[model samples]
Target: MKYIVVKLGGSTLEQLPPTFYKNIVELHQSKEWSPIIVHGGGPLISSLLKSLQIETQFINGLRVTDQNVLDIVEMVLSGSVNKQIVRHLISAKGNAFGISGVDGGLLNSQPVEGAKELGFVGEVVDVNTDMIKEIIQKGYIPVISPIGIDENGQRYNINGDIAASAIASALGANLCLISDIPGIYIEKDNIKHTLKNITKAEVEAMIEDGQIFGGMIPKVKAAIDGLVHDVPEVSIINGLEVDSLIAYCNGEEIGTKIVLNKESSYVK
Candidate 1:
């Protein structure tokens, strides 16, 4: 069966309607394509940190996670946010299994390139697809939180988008990032135009030129990273659009498709 990894960003998850969960349930029951959900909880984490009088910092788009912050991250992402998504799926009449990367060694990770500056932040080195496959074989949608663990019993905060991309690449599945907007947009004169297709080089250039900033940097960077790891393609789609997931699966043009090569067809 074909697989699709759907990533829900924290900013957009609360605004998504019930229909979004219903569409996910439909996909689970359809047998045409199996869906795996990976989600983030940045806003919730930040809120909790604030309430606890903890200071949080971000370099680029990634959160700098020390041990204290990592604990809160785990408590929020794996504990509350993960269950919330599962509950929504269940309410939509779907069987959902929620897990974090730390569970069952699902995501074996290592410190990222800049470990000194970004404490406890990791990049996935390997994924345990066997557990994920078994979860899929049992006819349940797997909802994943991006908290990763290393060999030394150390936990790391994995970027949700990067985690989804890693899982998609490992499963040989397509990655779809759910965003508040339809796709990446650039302002020309007075009108903002959505990019139908983009390449890794173009994405980097856009970032360098300040066309893409803030949280978008990580999404596009994650897409490019997934492409580098052999994920067939990654699409950024708006979850607020009714049946947007279905539209993407139906081959309807609805979002930006990011590719590694310029020669690829972006129509689909």
Candidate 2:
């Protein structure tokens, strides 16, 4: 019953190496860790929209999806990216089943607070945890695409990180956010180094000091949210590295582990 939710960024999805797939297969076959993949296709979706002469817009990092855009999003995410991951895993001798939040109401959500401004963007309110757990227990790795739906059949595009966090939170599973970089970097003796373990307070202070900025903001924020939601573990790992996943599964720290708090010190 050891489950880990791996959130693959769009960049990782674009260049997921064969070793990565094989590693996932190994983890699944070993029965030590049940890995669930949640993936995004931002670049692919954007490219398709451009090719079709569609206008794409984003607000606060959330895509403003219209009806036509939603159609393409679903096609690229649930159809293309989802299957592609499954295909790669299957090719590596792994059993995988691709699905979306919209299918079987896996992620029931309502329009994000300001739906009028950011059309069709929803935040997950509920997750069908039982279904996902069942899929995993049945020996099928559940590869999820972050496309959610409301009760009235209105579909909304979800941020992949947020979607993964919600699912992991619901299942009380460990979450690994696959990032382009190795991990959180800190300057040590005039040289920058990655922090192996960190706490939310330390990360917040780093952000305040401008040490953590740019695209990494959302990731650290998501990690904090996962911790707040009672997820047992959360880490940011590099998807490009061949041994990252395996190393993590073996408990040989390969990324920045986000913990609820740091060790307390007694000030004399």
Candidate 3:
């Protein structure tokens, strides 16, 4: 079966716009392809930490996951956010199951000891695909949380983008990242949207030239990694659009498609 792995950003999750859910359901009923969802819960985790009076920090866009922050990350990402997405999918008639990187040793990781002060954040070293395959074989969409396990059986927090990219790469699936904006904009404030197909090198040059900066930097980097790792195509689409995901999956041009090399134009 043709497979696509989609990473829904935390901001998108918080919005939970009706149109987004409807499109997902519509695609779920299509039976043309299988989708595996990997989601992030950064905003929720931050809110929860504030409620608990825990200070939050970030180093190079990744949360500085000390033990306490790691606890909150697991709670929000694995417990609350994971279940919320699973419930939404099931309610929409999409067969969905919630899972984490730690379940069944799905993602084995090593501590990112580059900065010892960062505590329990991890980098994925291995991915066990058996459990994911089992769920796919059973006809259930696997909705994954980003928490991972370390060599010493310790749980560690992981960057959601990194986690999602790793899962897509391991599965050799087409990857899509759903965000609030319409892909990577050449100018964030400008109303004009450039939806042209682009290459990894072109994106890098844009970044170097300052056309792409700020929040888009990491996302484009993630897309580049996915393309380089053998996933044929990666896209960044507007999550708020009613049928953006379905349109992209059906080969209808609705988002910015990132590719490794320039090729003949073909949609659908």
Candidate 4:
């Protein structure tokens, strides 16, 4: 089965139009692709923590996740955010089922090396595809939360971008990173334009030159990683668009697609 692994950013998860979910149904009806979603919930988690009077902070764009923070992160990502995506799909006449990395050993991870200061945040060591495969085989889109587990059954928070990339690598699937932004942009002669295509080397240079910084640094890195690891394709697209998802699946040029080399890049 051809799989399209989508990573939905939390910034616009709740606000995605019904058309986006309708495109998901189109993928199912097309009989050529299976959609699996991996989602993040940063804004909602922060909102809930603030309302609950729990203090939290990020170190270099990575959330500091102590036990208190991990509890809230999981609750938001696995509960509210995951359900909202699944419900939205179903409401649009699509079938979706939500799961977390903690469920059925979907993601086994260990604490990120040299970043112990970040607390329970971990790097995904492996992705178990059995559960996700079964869900897709049954015709339900699997919505995943980036909450990982260790062999000892300890839960760790995984960066959604990294988790999505790792899962794509494990499955050798196409990855579409859905976010609030349409695509990466460059300024020339004071005109800013979104780049429809870019090469991995160009993106690396952009990151090194600090042209790419903050959270986008990680997403770009994840996209590049997916490409390097043999994922057929990877794109960072605007999730808020009415047809971005379908356009990507249909091979239309609409979002920022990352490529292994300039041979596949058509940056105009």
Ranking by TM-score: 1, 4, 2, 3
Error of 4 at 152 (Å): 0.8
Model 1 Cα lDDT, one tens digit per residue, 114-232: 98999999999999999999999998999999988889878999999999999999998999999999898877677778888888878888889898888888888999988988898
lDDT of 3 by residue, 1-268 (tens): 6778889999888776767766666665667777888898888998999999999987656678887888889989999999999888877777888999999888898887554877888877777878888997887888999899976789988777777777788889888889887775554455555655777778878778877775467677777887777777888888888778878887888778888778523221
Look at candidate 1 and tell me the lDDT of residue 206.
Answer: 85
Clashing residue pairs, backbone N/CA/C < 3 A, model 3: none
Task: Write one digit per residue (lDDT tens) for candidate 2, span 16-127.
Answer: 7888989988988888888989998999999999999999987656788889999999999999999999999999999999999998999998898789988888889999
TM-score of each: 0.97, 0.91, 0.89, 0.94
The lDDT of model 4 is 0.87
TM-score, model 3 to reference: 0.89
Quote the positional error of residue 75 for candidate 2 in Å. 1.3
The Cα local distance difference test for each model comes to: 0.92, 0.87, 0.80, 0.87
Maximum-lDDT candidate: 1
Give the local distance difference test score of model 3.
Answer: 0.80
- After superposition on all C-alphas, the RMSD of every candidate to the true structure, in Å, is 2.2, 3.0, 3.4, 1.8
The number of the candidate with the highest TM-score is: 1
C-alpha RMSD (angstroms) for model 2:
3.0
Give the worst 10-residue stretch by lDDT in candidate 1.
259-268
* Off by more than 4 A, model 1: 263-268
